[model samples]
Target: MELYFLGTNAGVPTLQRNVTSIALRLLEERRSIWMFDCGEGTQHQVLRSPIRLGKLEKIFITHLHGDHLFGLPGLLSSRGYQGGTSPLTVYGPPGLKAYLDISLAVSQSRIPYKIEIVEHTGGTVFEDEGFKVEAALLEHRIDSYGYRVTEKDSPGSLNTELLKSYGLKPGPIYGKLKKGEDVITDEGVRICAADVVREPKRGRIVTILGDTRPCSGALELSLHADLIVHEATFAHDLAEMAHQYHHSTARQAAELAQEADAGQLLLTHFSSRYSSFEELIPLLEEAELIFPETLLAEEFSAYPIYRRQNGQLGK
Candidate 1:
Protein backbone atom coordinates (compact mmCIF):
# COMPACT_ATOMS: atom_id res chain seq x y z
CA MET A 1 0.00 0.00 0.00
CA GLU A 2 1.11 3.59 -0.67
CA LEU A 3 -0.07 6.92 0.72
CA TYR A 4 -0.08 9.86 -1.66
CA PHE A 5 -0.21 13.31 -0.12
CA LEU A 6 -2.23 15.41 -2.53
CA GLY A 7 -2.36 18.35 -0.14
CA THR A 8 -0.67 18.67 3.25
CA ASN A 9 -1.13 22.28 4.33
CA ALA A 10 -3.45 23.28 7.18
CA GLY A 11 -6.29 25.82 7.31
CA VAL A 12 -5.81 27.55 3.95
CA PRO A 13 -3.84 27.16 0.77
CA THR A 14 -0.42 28.72 0.42
CA LEU A 15 1.98 29.20 -2.42
CA GLN A 16 3.95 26.20 -1.24
CA ARG A 17 1.13 24.06 0.19
CA ASN A 18 -2.51 23.28 -0.45
CA VAL A 19 -5.19 22.31 2.05
CA THR A 20 -5.56 18.88 3.68
CA SER A 21 -6.10 15.99 1.27
CA ILE A 22 -4.60 12.48 1.09
CA ALA A 23 -4.98 9.53 -1.25
CA LEU A 24 -4.48 6.00 -0.01
CA ARG A 25 -3.42 4.06 -3.09
CA LEU A 26 -4.70 0.50 -2.70
CA LEU A 27 -4.02 -0.76 -6.22
CA GLU A 28 -2.01 -3.65 -4.79
CA GLU A 29 -4.83 -4.75 -2.50
CA ARG A 30 -7.85 -3.35 -4.33
CA ARG A 31 -8.35 -1.87 -7.76
CA SER A 32 -9.43 1.51 -6.38
CA ILE A 33 -7.93 4.40 -4.45
CA TRP A 34 -9.41 5.71 -1.20
CA MET A 35 -9.24 9.44 -0.54
CA PHE A 36 -9.20 11.14 2.88
CA ASP A 37 -10.19 14.78 3.36
CA CYS A 38 -10.70 16.42 -0.04
CA GLY A 39 -9.48 19.92 0.62
CA GLU A 40 -9.90 22.90 -1.70
CA GLY A 41 -8.55 22.34 -5.22
CA THR A 42 -8.18 18.63 -4.53
CA GLN A 43 -9.27 17.66 -8.03
CA HIS A 44 -6.62 19.98 -9.39
CA GLN A 45 -4.02 18.14 -7.35
CA VAL A 46 -5.25 14.79 -8.59
CA LEU A 47 -5.07 16.03 -12.15
CA ARG A 48 -1.35 16.58 -11.71
CA SER A 49 -0.74 13.06 -10.46
CA PRO A 50 -1.17 9.68 -12.11
CA ILE A 51 -4.38 9.15 -10.07
CA ARG A 52 -7.49 8.39 -12.10
CA LEU A 53 -10.52 10.33 -11.00
CA GLY A 54 -12.78 7.47 -12.11
CA LYS A 55 -11.04 5.06 -9.75
CA LEU A 56 -11.82 7.03 -6.58
CA GLU A 57 -14.27 4.69 -4.90
CA LYS A 58 -14.29 5.98 -1.33
CA ILE A 59 -13.90 9.33 0.40
CA PHE A 60 -13.53 9.84 4.16
CA ILE A 61 -13.95 13.34 5.49
CA THR A 62 -12.48 14.20 8.87
CA HIS A 63 -14.49 17.36 9.53
CA LEU A 64 -16.56 20.07 7.88
CA HIS A 65 -13.75 22.56 7.87
CA GLY A 66 -13.31 24.20 4.46
CA ASP A 67 -9.72 23.12 4.26
CA HIS A 68 -10.77 19.54 4.84
CA LEU A 69 -13.81 19.28 2.54
CA PHE A 70 -14.19 22.25 0.20
CA GLY A 71 -13.37 20.21 -2.87
CA LEU A 72 -16.21 17.71 -2.52
CA PRO A 73 -18.55 19.30 -5.03
CA GLY A 74 -15.89 19.84 -7.65
CA LEU A 75 -14.52 16.34 -7.27
CA LEU A 76 -17.95 14.77 -7.53
CA SER A 77 -18.78 16.83 -10.60
CA SER A 78 -15.50 15.91 -12.23
CA ARG A 79 -16.01 12.26 -11.43
CA GLY A 80 -19.28 12.35 -13.34
CA TYR A 81 -17.63 14.06 -16.25
CA GLN A 82 -14.87 11.45 -16.20
CA GLY A 83 -17.45 8.67 -16.63
CA GLY A 84 -17.43 7.34 -13.10
CA THR A 85 -20.57 5.23 -13.15
CA SER A 86 -19.82 3.09 -10.10
CA PRO A 87 -21.37 3.98 -6.78
CA LEU A 88 -19.11 5.93 -4.43
CA THR A 89 -19.43 5.94 -0.65
CA VAL A 90 -18.38 8.91 1.50
CA TYR A 91 -18.10 8.68 5.31
CA GLY A 92 -17.90 11.58 7.71
CA PRO A 93 -19.40 13.10 10.83
CA PRO A 94 -22.93 14.50 11.02
CA GLY A 95 -23.97 17.42 8.74
CA LEU A 96 -21.91 16.18 5.82
CA LYS A 97 -25.02 15.29 3.89
CA ALA A 98 -26.36 18.83 4.12
CA TYR A 99 -22.96 20.23 3.22
CA LEU A 100 -22.71 18.20 0.04
CA ASP A 101 -26.34 18.82 -0.83
CA ILE A 102 -25.96 22.57 -0.57
CA SER A 103 -22.76 22.60 -2.55
CA LEU A 104 -24.17 20.45 -5.34
CA ALA A 105 -27.35 22.49 -5.46
CA VAL A 106 -25.59 25.82 -5.50
CA SER A 107 -23.10 24.74 -8.17
CA GLN A 108 -25.75 22.89 -10.21
CA SER A 109 -23.49 19.86 -10.30
CA ARG A 110 -24.89 16.60 -11.62
CA ILE A 111 -23.52 13.24 -10.63
CA PRO A 112 -24.00 10.35 -13.01
CA TYR A 113 -23.31 7.75 -10.34
CA LYS A 114 -24.92 6.81 -7.05
CA ILE A 115 -23.39 8.68 -4.13
CA GLU A 116 -23.94 7.16 -0.70
CA ILE A 117 -23.28 9.40 2.28
CA VAL A 118 -22.72 7.73 5.65
CA GLU A 119 -22.65 10.15 8.56
CA HIS A 120 -21.34 8.15 11.48
CA THR A 121 -20.98 8.81 15.20
CA GLY A 122 -17.43 7.73 16.00
CA GLY A 123 -17.21 3.96 15.63
CA THR A 124 -16.58 1.33 12.96
CA VAL A 125 -17.75 3.39 10.00
CA PHE A 126 -16.90 1.00 7.19
CA GLU A 127 -15.98 -2.65 6.75
CA ASP A 128 -15.66 -4.94 3.75
CA GLU A 129 -13.89 -8.13 2.79
CA GLY A 130 -10.57 -6.32 2.30
CA PHE A 131 -10.47 -3.79 5.14
CA LYS A 132 -12.19 -2.32 8.21
CA VAL A 133 -12.34 1.38 9.09
CA GLU A 134 -13.02 2.68 12.59
CA ALA A 135 -13.44 6.25 13.74
CA ALA A 136 -12.95 8.11 17.04
CA LEU A 137 -14.16 11.57 17.93
CA LEU A 138 -11.35 14.10 18.11
CA GLU A 139 -10.86 17.28 20.13
CA HIS A 140 -11.40 19.93 17.51
CA ARG A 141 -13.36 23.16 17.40
CA ILE A 142 -15.98 21.41 15.34
CA ASP A 143 -17.18 17.83 15.64
CA SER A 144 -14.13 16.16 14.16
CA TYR A 145 -13.04 12.51 13.92
CA GLY A 146 -9.90 10.44 13.40
CA TYR A 147 -9.94 7.25 11.38
CA ARG A 148 -8.17 3.91 11.87
CA VAL A 149 -7.93 1.75 8.74
CA THR A 150 -7.03 -1.91 9.22
CA GLU A 151 -6.59 -4.14 6.19
CA LYS A 152 -7.76 -7.71 6.52
CA ASP A 153 -5.19 -10.45 6.96
CA SER A 154 -4.21 -12.15 3.73
CA PRO A 155 -4.35 -15.93 3.22
CA GLY A 156 -1.17 -17.94 3.72
CA SER A 157 0.93 -18.98 0.74
CA LEU A 158 1.19 -22.64 -0.07
CA ASN A 159 4.59 -24.32 0.33
CA THR A 160 5.35 -25.70 -3.12
CA GLU A 161 8.17 -27.92 -1.86
CA LEU A 162 6.00 -29.42 0.84
CA LEU A 163 3.21 -30.05 -1.66
CA LYS A 164 5.62 -31.83 -4.04
CA SER A 165 7.07 -33.86 -1.15
CA TYR A 166 3.54 -35.10 -0.42
CA GLY A 167 3.18 -36.20 -4.07
CA LEU A 168 0.57 -33.55 -4.69
CA LYS A 169 1.02 -32.16 -8.20
CA PRO A 170 0.40 -28.48 -8.72
CA GLY A 171 -3.19 -27.91 -10.02
CA PRO A 172 -6.59 -26.93 -8.70
CA ILE A 173 -5.70 -28.93 -5.59
CA TYR A 174 -3.07 -26.34 -4.76
CA GLY A 175 -5.71 -23.67 -4.87
CA LYS A 176 -7.90 -25.70 -2.56
CA LEU A 177 -5.02 -26.27 -0.17
CA LYS A 178 -4.28 -22.54 -0.10
CA LYS A 179 -7.91 -22.06 0.87
CA GLY A 180 -7.32 -24.30 3.90
CA GLU A 181 -9.23 -27.38 2.70
CA ASP A 182 -8.57 -31.03 3.49
CA VAL A 183 -8.28 -33.15 0.38
CA ILE A 184 -7.73 -36.87 -0.16
CA THR A 185 -4.80 -37.54 -2.48
CA ASP A 186 -4.71 -40.13 -5.31
CA GLU A 187 -2.83 -42.44 -2.92
CA GLY A 188 -5.80 -42.40 -0.47
CA VAL A 189 -3.75 -40.21 1.94
CA ARG A 190 -5.48 -37.29 3.54
CA ILE A 191 -3.49 -34.04 3.28
CA CYS A 192 -4.27 -31.21 5.68
CA ALA A 193 -3.70 -27.63 4.48
CA ALA A 194 -2.42 -26.45 7.85
CA ASP A 195 0.58 -28.75 7.63
CA VAL A 196 1.72 -27.46 4.27
CA VAL A 197 0.94 -23.72 4.41
CA ARG A 198 2.65 -20.93 6.28
CA GLU A 199 0.92 -18.60 8.69
CA PRO A 200 -1.36 -15.89 7.31
CA LYS A 201 0.30 -12.55 6.71
CA ARG A 202 -0.78 -9.82 9.10
CA GLY A 203 -2.49 -6.81 7.55
CA ARG A 204 -1.14 -3.27 7.75
CA ILE A 205 -2.73 -0.66 9.98
CA VAL A 206 -2.83 3.03 9.03
CA THR A 207 -4.29 5.71 11.28
CA ILE A 208 -5.03 9.22 10.00
CA LEU A 209 -6.19 11.97 12.34
CA GLY A 210 -8.10 15.13 11.58
CA ASP A 211 -7.22 18.55 12.91
CA THR A 212 -7.20 18.30 16.70
CA ARG A 213 -5.26 18.96 19.85
CA PRO A 214 -3.52 16.27 21.88
CA CYS A 215 -6.33 14.00 23.11
CA SER A 216 -6.98 10.45 24.27
CA GLY A 217 -8.91 9.61 21.12
CA ALA A 218 -5.89 10.38 18.98
CA LEU A 219 -3.72 8.15 21.11
CA GLU A 220 -6.27 5.34 20.97
CA LEU A 221 -6.61 5.53 17.20
CA SER A 222 -2.85 5.46 16.71
CA LEU A 223 -1.99 2.59 19.03
CA HIS A 224 0.36 0.10 17.35
CA ALA A 225 -0.29 1.55 13.90
CA ASP A 226 2.09 0.88 11.07
CA LEU A 227 1.72 4.50 9.94
CA ILE A 228 0.17 7.40 11.88
CA VAL A 229 -0.77 10.56 9.96
CA HIS A 230 -1.57 13.42 12.33
CA GLU A 231 -2.02 17.12 11.83
CA ALA A 232 0.63 19.54 13.03
CA THR A 233 -0.85 22.96 12.43
CA PHE A 234 1.74 24.78 14.46
CA ALA A 235 5.26 24.57 15.81
CA HIS A 236 6.13 23.53 19.34
CA ASP A 237 6.62 27.12 20.47
CA LEU A 238 3.00 27.85 19.61
CA ALA A 239 1.58 25.30 22.00
CA GLU A 240 -0.78 27.85 23.55
CA MET A 241 -2.03 28.96 20.14
CA ALA A 242 -2.39 25.35 19.07
CA HIS A 243 -4.49 24.55 22.12
CA GLN A 244 -6.59 27.64 21.62
CA TYR A 245 -7.24 26.77 17.98
CA HIS A 246 -7.77 23.06 18.74
CA HIS A 247 -4.80 22.13 16.59
CA SER A 248 -1.68 20.15 17.42
CA THR A 249 1.93 21.27 17.35
CA ALA A 250 4.70 19.31 15.72
CA ARG A 251 6.18 18.21 19.02
CA GLN A 252 2.77 17.27 20.38
CA ALA A 253 2.10 15.07 17.35
CA ALA A 254 5.46 13.35 17.86
CA GLU A 255 4.70 12.76 21.52
CA LEU A 256 1.40 11.12 20.64
CA ALA A 257 3.16 8.81 18.15
CA GLN A 258 5.67 7.82 20.80
CA GLU A 259 2.92 7.21 23.34
CA ALA A 260 0.93 5.12 20.91
CA ASP A 261 4.02 3.09 19.90
CA ALA A 262 3.38 3.73 16.22
CA GLY A 263 5.90 2.38 13.76
CA GLN A 264 6.11 5.69 11.86
CA LEU A 265 4.72 9.16 12.50
CA LEU A 266 3.96 11.53 9.60
CA LEU A 267 3.37 15.17 10.53
CA THR A 268 1.25 17.29 8.15
CA HIS A 269 -1.33 20.13 8.07
CA PHE A 270 1.37 22.76 8.39
CA SER A 271 0.47 26.40 8.86
CA SER A 272 1.46 28.90 6.14
CA ARG A 273 3.39 31.11 8.51
CA TYR A 274 6.54 29.02 8.06
CA SER A 275 7.98 29.61 4.62
CA SER A 276 10.65 27.00 5.12
CA PHE A 277 9.66 23.48 6.15
CA GLU A 278 13.16 22.91 7.52
CA GLU A 279 12.07 24.62 10.73
CA LEU A 280 10.15 21.49 11.66
CA ILE A 281 13.31 19.37 11.96
CA PRO A 282 14.13 20.44 15.49
CA LEU A 283 10.57 19.88 16.54
CA LEU A 284 10.62 16.43 14.94
CA GLU A 285 13.93 15.71 16.63
CA GLU A 286 12.30 16.52 19.95
CA ALA A 287 9.70 13.91 19.15
CA GLU A 288 12.34 11.40 17.92
CA LEU A 289 13.87 11.64 21.34
CA ILE A 290 10.88 9.53 22.29
CA PHE A 291 10.03 7.87 18.94
CA PRO A 292 12.74 7.62 16.36
CA GLU A 293 10.48 7.03 13.34
CA THR A 294 9.04 10.54 13.10
CA LEU A 295 8.74 12.15 9.65
CA LEU A 296 7.54 15.49 8.34
CA ALA A 297 4.93 15.39 5.60
CA GLU A 298 5.27 17.15 2.26
CA GLU A 299 2.81 17.84 -0.50
CA PHE A 300 2.61 15.19 -3.25
CA SER A 301 4.94 12.88 -1.34
CA ALA A 302 4.35 9.12 -1.37
CA TYR A 303 5.20 6.80 1.50
CA PRO A 304 5.43 3.08 0.87
CA ILE A 305 4.22 0.55 3.47
CA TYR A 306 6.72 -2.28 3.66
CA ARG A 307 6.17 -5.68 5.22
CA ARG A 308 8.98 -6.95 7.42
CA GLN A 309 10.57 -10.40 7.25
CA ASN A 310 8.96 -11.49 10.53
CA GLY A 311 5.46 -10.91 9.03
CA GLN A 312 5.18 -7.60 10.90
CA LEU A 313 4.72 -4.14 9.37
CA GLY A 314 7.64 -1.76 8.91
CA LYS A 315 7.83 1.63 7.10
Candidate 2:
Protein backbone atom coordinates (compact mmCIF):
# COMPACT_ATOMS: atom_id res chain seq x y z
CA MET A 1 0.00 0.00 0.00
CA GLU A 2 1.09 3.56 -0.70
CA LEU A 3 0.10 6.64 1.33
CA TYR A 4 -0.44 9.89 -0.53
CA PHE A 5 -0.61 13.11 1.43
CA LEU A 6 -3.19 15.46 -0.07
CA GLY A 7 -3.04 18.15 2.65
CA THR A 8 -1.02 18.21 5.86
CA ASN A 9 -1.61 21.61 7.44
CA ALA A 10 -3.20 21.83 10.88
CA GLY A 11 -6.46 23.67 11.61
CA VAL A 12 -6.33 25.91 8.52
CA PRO A 13 -4.70 26.27 5.12
CA THR A 14 -1.50 28.14 4.45
CA LEU A 15 0.31 29.26 1.31
CA GLN A 16 2.41 26.13 1.31
CA ARG A 17 0.08 23.58 2.87
CA ASN A 18 -3.65 22.93 2.91
CA VAL A 19 -5.32 20.93 5.70
CA THR A 20 -5.66 17.33 6.86
CA SER A 21 -6.23 14.70 4.14
CA ILE A 22 -4.45 11.45 3.33
CA ALA A 23 -5.18 8.73 0.79
CA LEU A 24 -4.18 5.14 1.30
CA ARG A 25 -4.00 3.56 -2.15
CA LEU A 26 -4.25 -0.18 -2.46
CA LEU A 27 -4.18 -0.14 -6.23
CA GLU A 28 -1.92 -3.13 -6.64
CA GLU A 29 -3.74 -5.20 -4.02
CA ARG A 30 -7.35 -4.09 -4.17
CA ARG A 31 -7.52 -1.71 -7.15
CA SER A 32 -8.90 1.07 -4.98
CA ILE A 33 -7.96 3.81 -2.51
CA TRP A 34 -9.22 4.52 1.01
CA MET A 35 -9.14 8.09 2.23
CA PHE A 36 -8.29 8.77 5.87
CA ASP A 37 -9.48 12.37 6.32
CA CYS A 38 -10.91 14.89 3.84
CA GLY A 39 -10.09 18.45 4.80
CA GLU A 40 -11.10 21.53 2.80
CA GLY A 41 -9.79 21.68 -0.77
CA THR A 42 -9.16 17.94 -0.70
CA GLN A 43 -10.94 17.45 -4.02
CA HIS A 44 -8.66 20.08 -5.56
CA GLN A 45 -5.66 18.30 -4.18
CA VAL A 46 -6.77 15.00 -5.70
CA LEU A 47 -7.06 16.77 -9.04
CA ARG A 48 -3.34 17.55 -8.78
CA SER A 49 -2.51 13.87 -8.33
CA PRO A 50 -3.17 10.73 -10.38
CA ILE A 51 -5.90 9.76 -7.92
CA ARG A 52 -9.28 9.02 -9.49
CA LEU A 53 -12.38 9.80 -7.46
CA GLY A 54 -14.15 6.82 -9.00
CA LYS A 55 -11.67 4.45 -7.37
CA LEU A 56 -12.36 5.68 -3.85
CA GLU A 57 -13.89 2.70 -2.05
CA LYS A 58 -14.12 3.98 1.51
CA ILE A 59 -13.61 7.13 3.57
CA PHE A 60 -12.68 7.09 7.26
CA ILE A 61 -13.32 10.29 9.15
CA THR A 62 -11.53 10.74 12.44
CA HIS A 63 -13.83 13.45 13.72
CA LEU A 64 -16.30 16.09 12.61
CA HIS A 65 -13.81 18.95 12.68
CA GLY A 66 -14.35 21.46 9.88
CA ASP A 67 -10.79 21.08 8.66
CA HIS A 68 -11.18 17.30 8.50
CA LEU A 69 -14.64 17.16 6.97
CA PHE A 70 -15.47 20.46 5.26
CA GLY A 71 -14.51 19.12 1.86
CA LEU A 72 -16.37 15.84 2.21
CA PRO A 73 -19.66 17.00 0.72
CA GLY A 74 -18.03 18.58 -2.28
CA LEU A 75 -15.96 15.45 -2.83
CA LEU A 76 -18.98 13.20 -2.58
CA SER A 77 -20.89 15.37 -5.04
CA SER A 78 -18.04 15.59 -7.50
CA ARG A 79 -17.66 11.82 -7.50
CA GLY A 80 -21.17 11.63 -8.94
CA TYR A 81 -20.31 14.07 -11.72
CA GLN A 82 -17.15 12.15 -12.26
CA GLY A 83 -17.15 8.38 -13.01
CA GLY A 84 -17.91 6.92 -9.59
CA THR A 85 -20.61 4.24 -9.87
CA SER A 86 -19.74 1.70 -7.19
CA PRO A 87 -21.10 1.87 -3.65
CA LEU A 88 -19.07 3.79 -1.07
CA THR A 89 -18.94 3.44 2.70
CA VAL A 90 -18.00 6.07 5.29
CA TYR A 91 -16.98 5.42 8.90
CA GLY A 92 -16.93 8.11 11.54
CA PRO A 93 -18.36 9.36 14.86
CA PRO A 94 -22.11 9.68 15.52
CA GLY A 95 -22.68 13.14 13.97
CA LEU A 96 -21.06 12.34 10.67
CA LYS A 97 -24.13 10.85 9.03
CA ALA A 98 -26.28 13.80 10.10
CA TYR A 99 -23.73 16.33 8.85
CA LEU A 100 -23.54 14.73 5.42
CA ASP A 101 -27.28 14.21 5.32
CA ILE A 102 -28.02 17.89 6.00
CA SER A 103 -25.29 19.17 3.71
CA LEU A 104 -26.36 17.03 0.77
CA ALA A 105 -30.03 17.70 1.39
CA VAL A 106 -29.54 21.45 1.55
CA SER A 107 -27.60 21.49 -1.69
CA GLN A 108 -30.06 19.06 -3.35
CA SER A 109 -27.10 17.33 -4.87
CA ARG A 110 -27.62 14.10 -6.80
CA ILE A 111 -25.54 11.02 -6.02
CA PRO A 112 -25.19 8.24 -8.55
CA TYR A 113 -24.08 5.55 -6.13
CA LYS A 114 -25.15 4.27 -2.73
CA ILE A 115 -23.32 5.61 0.33
CA GLU A 116 -23.22 3.74 3.62
CA ILE A 117 -22.52 5.76 6.74
CA VAL A 118 -21.36 3.85 9.79
CA GLU A 119 -21.35 5.64 13.14
CA HIS A 120 -18.78 3.93 15.27
CA THR A 121 -18.35 4.12 19.06
CA GLY A 122 -14.77 2.85 19.19
CA GLY A 123 -14.31 -0.82 18.28
CA THR A 124 -13.93 -2.87 15.11
CA VAL A 125 -15.31 -0.47 12.56
CA PHE A 126 -14.77 -2.67 9.51
CA GLU A 127 -13.44 -6.07 8.63
CA ASP A 128 -13.31 -8.08 5.38
CA GLU A 129 -11.35 -10.93 3.98
CA GLY A 130 -8.43 -8.77 2.96
CA PHE A 131 -8.22 -6.23 5.80
CA LYS A 132 -9.64 -5.17 9.17
CA VAL A 133 -9.98 -1.78 10.84
CA GLU A 134 -10.11 -1.14 14.58
CA ALA A 135 -11.04 2.23 16.06
CA ALA A 136 -10.36 3.69 19.50
CA LEU A 137 -11.43 6.97 21.03
CA LEU A 138 -8.65 9.53 21.34
CA GLU A 139 -8.15 12.54 23.60
CA HIS A 140 -9.16 15.56 21.56
CA ARG A 141 -11.50 18.50 21.62
CA ILE A 142 -14.17 16.31 20.05
CA ASP A 143 -14.83 12.60 19.96
CA SER A 144 -11.87 11.88 17.69
CA TYR A 145 -10.49 8.44 16.95
CA GLY A 146 -7.45 6.53 15.73
CA TYR A 147 -7.65 3.62 13.30
CA ARG A 148 -5.47 0.56 12.99
CA VAL A 149 -5.61 -0.92 9.48
CA THR A 150 -4.16 -4.37 9.21
CA GLU A 151 -4.00 -6.65 6.16
CA LYS A 152 -4.62 -10.34 6.54
CA ASP A 153 -1.69 -12.74 6.42
CA SER A 154 -1.33 -14.41 3.02
CA PRO A 155 -0.16 -17.85 2.06
CA GLY A 156 3.52 -18.13 1.18
CA SER A 157 4.75 -18.52 -2.37
CA LEU A 158 5.05 -21.97 -3.91
CA ASN A 159 8.63 -23.24 -3.93
CA THR A 160 9.33 -23.62 -7.61
CA GLU A 161 12.66 -25.34 -6.98
CA LEU A 162 11.04 -27.94 -4.71
CA LEU A 163 8.26 -28.50 -7.22
CA LYS A 164 10.82 -28.93 -10.02
CA SER A 165 12.74 -31.45 -7.91
CA TYR A 166 9.54 -33.44 -7.62
CA GLY A 167 9.24 -33.37 -11.43
CA LEU A 168 6.07 -31.28 -11.21
CA LYS A 169 5.27 -28.70 -13.89
CA PRO A 170 3.31 -25.52 -13.26
CA GLY A 171 -0.40 -26.15 -13.90
CA PRO A 172 -3.65 -26.67 -11.97
CA ILE A 173 -1.68 -28.86 -9.58
CA TYR A 174 0.25 -25.79 -8.54
CA GLY A 175 -3.07 -24.17 -7.56
CA LYS A 176 -3.92 -27.23 -5.51
CA LEU A 177 -0.48 -27.05 -3.85
CA LYS A 178 -1.03 -23.43 -2.93
CA LYS A 179 -4.19 -24.52 -1.15
CA GLY A 180 -2.13 -26.93 1.00
CA GLU A 181 -3.38 -30.01 -0.80
CA ASP A 182 -1.51 -33.15 -1.81
CA VAL A 183 -1.86 -33.80 -5.50
CA ILE A 184 -0.71 -36.54 -7.84
CA THR A 185 0.77 -35.62 -11.18
CA ASP A 186 -0.10 -37.32 -14.50
CA GLU A 187 3.01 -39.47 -13.85
CA GLY A 188 1.32 -40.66 -10.60
CA VAL A 189 3.95 -39.00 -8.36
CA ARG A 190 2.42 -37.89 -5.04
CA ILE A 191 3.52 -34.41 -3.93
CA CYS A 192 2.91 -32.79 -0.58
CA ALA A 193 2.33 -29.01 -0.73
CA ALA A 194 3.62 -28.54 2.81
CA ASP A 195 7.04 -29.77 1.80
CA VAL A 196 7.22 -27.26 -1.06
CA VAL A 197 5.29 -24.21 0.07
CA ARG A 198 6.78 -21.76 2.54
CA GLU A 199 5.16 -20.44 5.70
CA PRO A 200 2.56 -17.66 5.69
CA LYS A 201 3.72 -14.07 5.33
CA ARG A 202 2.61 -11.65 7.99
CA GLY A 203 0.47 -8.71 6.91
CA ARG A 204 1.37 -5.04 7.14
CA ILE A 205 -0.08 -2.83 9.88
CA VAL A 206 -0.81 0.89 9.56
CA THR A 207 -2.10 3.37 12.11
CA ILE A 208 -3.62 6.73 11.29
CA LEU A 209 -4.68 9.07 14.07
CA GLY A 210 -6.88 12.10 13.93
CA ASP A 211 -6.31 15.36 15.83
CA THR A 212 -5.29 14.19 19.26
CA ARG A 213 -3.17 14.74 22.32
CA PRO A 214 -0.58 12.13 23.27
CA CYS A 215 -2.90 9.42 24.59
CA SER A 216 -3.09 5.67 25.27
CA GLY A 217 -5.42 5.29 22.30
CA ALA A 218 -2.71 6.56 19.96
CA LEU A 219 -0.24 4.12 21.49
CA GLU A 220 -2.61 1.21 21.10
CA LEU A 221 -3.29 2.10 17.48
CA SER A 222 0.42 2.42 16.70
CA LEU A 223 1.65 -0.71 18.41
CA HIS A 224 4.09 -2.48 16.04
CA ALA A 225 2.71 -0.55 13.11
CA ASP A 226 4.67 -0.58 9.90
CA LEU A 227 3.75 3.03 9.33
CA ILE A 228 1.90 5.57 11.50
CA VAL A 229 0.50 8.98 10.59
CA HIS A 230 0.18 11.21 13.65
CA GLU A 231 -0.72 14.82 14.09
CA ALA A 232 1.83 17.38 15.29
CA THR A 233 -0.05 20.60 15.64
CA PHE A 234 2.52 22.55 17.62
CA ALA A 235 6.23 23.09 18.04
CA HIS A 236 8.03 21.88 21.14
CA ASP A 237 8.36 25.40 22.51
CA LEU A 238 4.57 25.75 22.50
CA ALA A 239 3.97 22.37 24.17
CA GLU A 240 1.98 24.07 26.90
CA MET A 241 -0.24 25.72 24.30
CA ALA A 242 -0.59 22.37 22.56
CA HIS A 243 -1.85 20.81 25.78
CA GLN A 244 -4.30 23.68 26.28
CA TYR A 245 -5.68 23.13 22.80
CA HIS A 246 -5.75 19.37 23.18
CA HIS A 247 -3.18 19.03 20.40
CA SER A 248 0.14 17.28 20.24
CA THR A 249 3.55 18.85 19.76
CA ALA A 250 6.18 17.43 17.40
CA ARG A 251 8.15 16.02 20.30
CA GLN A 252 5.01 14.56 21.86
CA ALA A 253 4.09 12.83 18.60
CA ALA A 254 7.58 11.41 18.21
CA GLU A 255 7.51 10.19 21.82
CA LEU A 256 4.33 8.25 21.09
CA ALA A 257 5.96 6.62 18.03
CA GLN A 258 9.00 5.63 20.06
CA GLU A 259 6.89 4.35 22.93
CA ALA A 260 4.77 2.24 20.62
CA ASP A 261 7.84 0.86 18.78
CA ALA A 262 6.38 1.87 15.44
CA GLY A 263 8.58 0.97 12.48
CA GLN A 264 8.09 4.41 10.91
CA LEU A 265 6.23 7.57 11.87
CA LEU A 266 4.93 10.22 9.47
CA LEU A 267 3.97 13.51 11.14
CA THR A 268 1.28 15.76 9.69
CA HIS A 269 -1.31 18.41 10.65
CA PHE A 270 1.41 21.06 10.97
CA SER A 271 0.43 24.36 12.56
CA SER A 272 -0.06 27.11 10.00
CA ARG A 273 2.40 29.44 11.70
CA TYR A 274 5.25 27.39 10.25
CA SER A 275 4.40 27.97 6.65
CA SER A 276 7.91 28.11 5.24
CA PHE A 277 10.22 25.10 5.05
CA GLU A 278 12.80 26.83 7.25
CA GLU A 279 10.23 27.59 9.95
CA LEU A 280 9.14 23.92 10.06
CA ILE A 281 12.73 22.68 10.46
CA PRO A 282 12.92 23.34 14.17
CA LEU A 283 9.78 21.35 14.84
CA LEU A 284 10.97 18.36 12.82
CA GLU A 285 14.55 18.56 14.14
CA GLU A 286 13.32 18.22 17.72
CA ALA A 287 11.10 15.28 16.77
CA GLU A 288 14.02 13.49 15.09
CA LEU A 289 15.81 13.52 18.42
CA ILE A 290 13.24 11.19 19.95
CA PHE A 291 12.46 9.04 16.91
CA PRO A 292 14.89 9.01 14.02
CA GLU A 293 12.35 7.16 11.89
CA THR A 294 9.99 10.15 12.11
CA LEU A 295 9.26 11.85 8.81
CA LEU A 296 7.55 15.17 8.18
CA ALA A 297 4.73 14.65 5.71
CA GLU A 298 4.59 16.95 2.68
CA GLU A 299 1.58 17.57 0.49
CA PHE A 300 1.50 15.38 -2.65
CA SER A 301 4.22 13.17 -1.20
CA ALA A 302 3.72 9.42 -1.52
CA TYR A 303 5.28 6.96 0.91
CA PRO A 304 5.30 3.26 0.08
CA ILE A 305 5.01 0.87 3.01
CA TYR A 306 7.32 -2.14 2.74
CA ARG A 307 7.92 -5.27 4.76
CA ARG A 308 11.51 -5.40 5.91
CA GLN A 309 13.50 -8.58 6.27
CA ASN A 310 12.84 -8.63 10.00
CA GLY A 311 9.08 -8.70 9.28
CA GLN A 312 8.73 -5.12 10.54
CA LEU A 313 7.27 -2.28 8.45
CA GLY A 314 9.31 0.45 6.78
CA LYS A 315 8.88 3.20 4.20
Number of the predicted model whose TM-score against the real structure is largest: 2
Q: Which lDDT tens digits does candidate 2 get at residues 49-142?
A: 9889999999999999999999999999999888999999999999999999999999999999999999998999999999999999999999
Q: Report the C-alpha displacement of residue 58, candidate 2, in angstroms.
A: 0.3
* Candidate 1: regions farther than 4 A off: 308-315
Kindly provide the TM-score of model 2 when superposed on the true structure, using C-alpha atoms. 0.96
Clashes of 1: 0
Candidate 1 lDDT tens digits, 224-303:
88899988888788899999999988889888887887778888888888756786676677667776787888777899
Least accurate 10 contiguous residues by lDDT in model 2: 306-315
Candidate 2 stretches greater than 4 Å from native: 184-189, 311-315
The TM-score measured for candidate 1 stands at 0.95
Per-candidate TM-score against the hidden true structure? 0.95, 0.96
In angstroms, the error of model 2 at 72 is 0.5
Error of 1 at 115 (Å): 0.7
